[model samples]
Target: MFQLLIVDDEASVVDSLADTLPWHEIGISTVFKAYSGSEALELLKTNTIDIMMTDIRMPGLNGLELLALVRREWKRIKCILLSGHAEFSYAQQAIQHDAHEYLLKPISDGEVLDKVGNLVGILQRERDESRHYERVEKAFQEHLPKLQGDLLADLLQGVKISPERLGQKLESLKIAIPAEGRFALMLFRLEDRFAELDFYSLSLMEYAVVNMAEELFEDDFRLWSCKDLHGYLVFLVTIAGEGDTQQDRQEHPDRAAEPVESRLQSMASQLQLSVDRFLKGSVSVLISRWGSFPLDIKRLYEDILLSMRKQVGNQSGLLIYASDELEQLPVHALQRLYEPPMLVHLLESGDWEKTHDKLTGIWSELGAKWADSQEHLLEAFFSIYASFSSFAHKNGRQLTDMIGPHLSDVTGLTPSRSLEALQQWMFQSLELLQQCMENETRNDRENTVRRIKLFVQKHLVEDVSLQAIADYMYMHPVHVSRIFKLETGENLSDFVLRLKMEQAAFLLADPSLKNYEVALQLGYQNPNYFIKVFKKYYSLTPQEFRQKLEAVEEQ
Candidate 1:
């Protein structure tokens, strides 16, 4: 409920207003009366006054003076001025003092009530907006972990953020990890035992796992944990040593190493034990070698992801430390095949010769250095096979369908154990891809043309933009337009216009419709443009076409 104060030098005016105004109807429960401005000031000190209505000419403390004092003391109190004189200076003073209303002395109760009602609305709105802000702040606090998790996930997925900008973000999000501190990343993968659970239950289990991790490492390190892009639980861990700054710790590596590594290993074991005991799930922890923050994070993530790939289905419940001697793969070795316009993209676009040449470049580079190593050979094989499988699957075919009986020999590590066998398998797979692209390209072009025609027919009276059609087919418009022209021997734009004109001709056969009405029916807004287009297509305007049709029907 809101409270109001009525102040005047004349006690009758104050008393009349206090007793007669409909305070409760406009959400005001109590009205206080004061005979002078000083009395009003005293009332303001004790009461939560929402509004104050006062006579301007009070003797001891005038209304404008009282309002100025109130503005200093209680800024929230909305003031209204009442006076016998209609002086320009008085109204100006009232407005300057931020009074809500200025009325001459003989104001009606309705006028006073209306002004107060508006002020009450302002107060209520302020309260509502304030409450909404508070609720939003509370929600942000509750979901801060998830937000931080998403940010960490993006970072691990190789999304770049500058160090200064990243530090600002960390400060704003209240994350405690230092921007340049040395840290380790760990990947946690849940075993088959917990895989059958629903997503929500699995999420709860993951949250519990993070909480257990926080508890385990809270004493020795700062942990920023999140689910990485590939659904692995990833943690960026920094040591929490006392009395030493990050620079100091970096300078004194000998003192920090033994204790920190031992603590991390111990904590990993405890985390696994806790999950096994409480959640009946086993997780493998793959820990990366220590690296500096922000810059090294993406590279570290890639290294750990490769490590995790090696232990799939064989190393559950194990804590594997990434090898310090492991060399970082050169950018061209893996990045070319994984990035855009890579082998898969070229194959999808039926660029057979380019796809073959790209693979040859990758193989030539790898064979130069790592040809004899079995592990390196397997990595190369899997990389090529995975990209091929992904492309084949996208084109509604399987890798087995392309490679046929040779799939088993290529996939088996024993047969492709030698570098020569691996090379042969790689080239053999490329040969098969080229052949499949040859046949699939023909079928795919036909299917694309059919789908485009169907889409055009379906959207004849609506927007049939080339980009929209390309989006529906999930290909670039320029590419689709080229393919359409190759397959249909006509440009896509010409096809659409022809179809629309044919539809317009069919609609023109109806005798009851007007020319403008038929243009609108064909999705054209300007009748003149529509008529010109109709003449260009059929050698007759819409009116001439309709008249010709009527003459034929009568004959």
Candidate 2:
């Protein structure tokens, strides 16, 4: 809340001004009054005032003196001086001391209100900009620490986060959970509508979505949301009371599962329809089965993410992760099918022996952990997808692209046939992913060289700044400077100067051009400055250099 102060020696004028304006509606918390500048100074010392209104003709320590003091003490406070046009000199003095505006006396409450409203709007905008900057600065500060946390780690590893930090961040986000409960995850994502809602508005909408989801669950259950770090609303619901009881089944089990499931399913369907209808947006949702909890939240999150692999590019509907819904497969056998990036990284830099060692180490670790016909096969698949999906996504391919459409066509005999089909599918997917990774790596290297050459060549004739190069490449100027030094073994400024000097040498040899014309062509406004640079480069002034070249040509 912003405080507003009104100062006038006339009791009637001060009283009317203070009472007439609806302070709270205009976002002012308190209105202070002072008959003299002495009284106003006392009020200012004790209170936080955002705006001050004073009449220049106050009996003692008048508006001009108060404005001076305000500039010295409360320099941040905006001042509006009240004086008649006849006392225009006092208004002029007030402006010199940083008075916000000089208003004519006997002003109506309507005029007073309008000025105050405009001031408040300006103040509000300034405060909001500060807050947004604070958020961005805070995010950067916490980025590394948060990267060590479960969410990013799991997303990168294609596995779940550790249990502790999952609960911590969830609680911090104001999502409630019951002890020793079961949970199901539902991912609600708005496609291409991220920029439509700003941060604060999106935060509120996510809270509203969570509250609506909580309503569908019983009183025992509590729902919490972990926002999509990549982009979506991830909801975790803790099923209260006992487990999915037989009593629940006896009381029409399908209907029991049906209500909460159906509502979420309906939300998924209706949300997409509504987004398209109202916001020109689209949505997709992926739901998880009632996974046992006090159970790992990270695993549950991973399951939801894996369900998205099945979603592909579709806009609407819900996919539930269930034991029955999962095709029985040899996920454990396939787990060894793809080596993670650690081994891949060793391969990337042409560290052939280290790559071989890392590959062997990964297989050795997997050989002991993965056994034939592992019971929690789908859970293993979830972990694998969770680890790699984010990598695929960050580099531009969705999980669906990695897995391929063959995933949809396969279904067969109980465990073996399903396992072999899935095994082949996952292997094929990994192969496609490996190729994608290789292509991206090569492209990045090629692009880096291309961007550097383009940046240098584009600014060849001009005295290009590091900032200009960085802007052209869409990167930090310091980073561009550092990269230029690293790749070319010369500072950016030095490189550009050398290139320009070499070009200038060629231009100086052209007898048709005058020194100033050559300077202009070489991007120097001052010909004398160009001569100095030319002297530094060739150890001769432009005239001396041209004389030598002419002597050599004549000889």
Candidate 3:
């Protein structure tokens, strides 16, 4: 809804304009009138006006004065001036005042409506843009935490993060942690008491644990936490700085690192206590020793994870704290498996080009970095193989149907399976699956277009609109139009029109049929409109076309 003000000195002029003009059609929900500039100013103050149309000359304060005041007070309200005097000076003043338009007196209703209609369009566009921005801003705010958590997950999973990139993401996500600092990894696992909880209940437990961890550690550490793919609650806790600068840290590295490790161990013990007391769930905590942020965090995760797995063997409510020992964790660079341009995302989107590129990058990275680790190679193979299997299942097909029974025995493959054998198997499987998907899509499209063509042929003398065809096919008009053009190389409307013209030509060749009868038979009620369309298509009137056809037949 929008408000407009019509200000003129003459009451009759204002009344006639308001009463006759279709204000609602132009999206002006309310029209306010004023016989004087003072009254207009008072109305402007009282209402939220979107546009103001004012006479240039009025009693007491004039239109130009009112325009200036409105521009100052209500900057968003658009203004237009009206006057009998079409003087250059007055137009210049109107332009200077930022009046949207200046129309002379005795303006036609069409001109006024056109000007106001254009302004209404502008207002609607402005409102839409504002709403779009606000929605985007709100969505970003809502997802800020998830985004920050994802970044942390990427870094902890050995995805390379440059210093500048890290700083930019930290700032964008509004995380207070410094990009270059001492940090540690913590892995928490809920014990057997809550192991029987459903997915939703487990999610609630994870949230409660994270909230409690934040409350306990936020004072001393900039904490980021998320449930990793392996179902462990992982935290990349950056140690807050002491009252010392980088140079001071260079002079006393142990002083900055050792105290934080001790404090984190104490905090982890207390976190376990809080979980047991309030949450009624016991959690085992694995705390890594302090390491440099981002660069050391991934290695720290690998080391602590391995340690926890080895030491905590079937134990619960235990704290497996890391020592000062730094193990050289192998660089898998397998983090690309979980990141963007990933095989799953590409496969889900059915983007063959990007999917091919992603598969190539994965194999290339494996050959360059993890070729020696047969275990890592097997892991990558299974990950991609599982994705393809899932893709096949979703399409109501089987991997064996696409590539034979060898792929179904993927779990039986050992680390001893040669890399070349695995790569060949994967490439062949993928190519076959891609071809199948493409064939299925093409067949589906051809079938839809075939149905639509039949529908149009049957309804040529009826309503052959795109929407009508879509309704018959039980599809959306946009989908019907797009696939029709893609499959037939012609617009849906053009196809319908061509069919109608063919029917018209057939009917016109019958000497017994009158022009109006032919028009009505082909679903055109107006003979003139039918003749005009026929001329546009055939370069002759219907009568001329019939005479030419008869002469040709006689010859």
Candidate 4:
């Protein structure tokens, strides 16, 4: 309900206007009457007003003074000025003071009510719009976490954001967590990739990691995960917990290193089941040395990443390692080893014989570097396939589909403990890959032809129909027509007409298809109109055409 106040020097005038106006019908349910601006100011102190009416010529404090006070203290309250004298000076003051309405001498109830009703509509619209804006803001705030998570995930993929712009966006997104004096970090690794190796494939596991990290931390932490430098998913966990050593003590003052180790083991045991249920993948955790916040976070994350590269000796998903376990495997080292004789050089020089022999040597070299099972053999495959996949996809083909089928089919050619077999597998895979490339190119052409056929069928009945099918497909109609005619060895319109006639001939023989049904089935909107076209094409009305076909069949 809108509260309204009426102020005039004459007590009877203020009361009469307030009582006579039927303000309730005009959306003002509560009313206050004041004989002067001073009295109205007092009333305003105790009451909230949506609209006000005052005499422009009130004694001592007039409507203009009251309007000024309202502007200062209650800017939302709308004002209307009343006056007995019809003076230009009074009207000028009302206009300057932002009075919503002005009426002279003995105002009728209906006129006042109409003016108030107009103001009420304006007030309601303003309120509704304000409410809508507030709701939209609240919803954006509520979903900030999920939005921030998605954004952080994209950022960690090495999607570029300049440093200054990065800081501004971080602030705006509310992920710029208070970097207190100290920070703690943890890197999580998903251990197994051979089960199904794919970057897009592990979206479920990444979601699980974010959820689990939230539950384990006390301090609010912003998280982002990426395939680490070692090719394992390293969760860069940065926490603004106090100095690590002090914070660890605060967490459990009585526990020694031995008990802490036991607790970590227990935490790992519980976490393994949860991770296994969701990921169907292996995992490992590397906790960073406690240090300062944000500044120390990147370095700590790198430590955890380095730890992921040093795979544990067992197949278990959970592995624990400190910085000591890390063995740097930067590409610069490989560049030094192959500067004079790079793999690309050997391959591009048409040294198939040399490249084949190099593969045999690398197989044993990798085996010696890690006397583990053939699991590490996959690391080489992943590296080679990654580069090859990029090259293939750039050339509009995928190498994985080519290599995967052959690997699945020919188990006899599989490499065991031998380098020669590995080379033979690589060479054989490439040969199969060539066939896949040809098939892919052929299939692309076939798909284009099929699409063109479908397009022609959809638009054949329309009068202004050249390239209508391609227009619907958002392609150049002429391009579609040219390609379609090239592939089918006929004009696009001829193909469309032939297809329409085939349907027409079928309808002519089928006794069940009514005339209107035949028209609709062949894409005509009007059955009578369709008959004219049918008669033109076949030299008979639709009914006559069908009857003639029947007569011929009977003969």
* Candidate whose lDDT is highest: 3
| Candidate 3 lDDT tens digits, 41-74 | 7677767999999998888999999999999999
* Model 3 CA deviation exceeding 4 Å by range: 1-132, 154-168, 177-180, 196-205, 242-258, 323-345, 365-390, 398-401, 404-417, 505-515, 526-555
Q: What is the lDDT of residue 109 in candidate 4?
A: 70
Report the Cα RMSD per candidate: 21.7, 20.1, 13.6, 24.9
Off by over 4 Å in 4: 1-146, 154-159, 178-184, 189-212, 219-235, 240-283, 289-302, 317-321, 324-555
lDDT of 2 at 382: 48
lDDT of 4 at 156: 37
Error of 2 at 444 (Å): 9.1
Best-to-worst order by lDDT is: 3, 1, 2, 4
Task: Name the regions of candidate 1 deviating beyond 4 angstroms.
Answer: 1-132, 242-258, 324-555
Best by TM-score: 3
Q: What is the Å distance of residue 274 in model 3 from its true position?
A: 2.7
lDDT of 2 by residue, 1-555 (tens): 798988887644664577446788888887876666876886688679999999888776988888899999987788898887566577578769988778887797778888888888888887877775887778856763343334433443344335686678546544455445556766777666644799897766665555555564544355455565566776655545435467865665444555665655655565456556755655666767765554544455655665676544454443444332233433523433342445334333545455445434443444456434444344444444454566566657776675565542324422223344435444455566666666766676457646876767776655354445665778755566666676667766677778778888899889999999998887777686678677866789989999999999999
- Tell me each candidate's TM-score: 0.41, 0.34, 0.64, 0.32
RMSD of 4: 24.9
Worst 10 residues of 2 by lDDT: 408-417
Candidate 2: stretches off by over 4 Å = 1-130, 133-158, 178-213, 216-218, 225-235, 239-366, 369-486, 489-493, 501-525, 528-555
The Cα local distance difference test for each model comes to: 0.80, 0.63, 0.81, 0.62
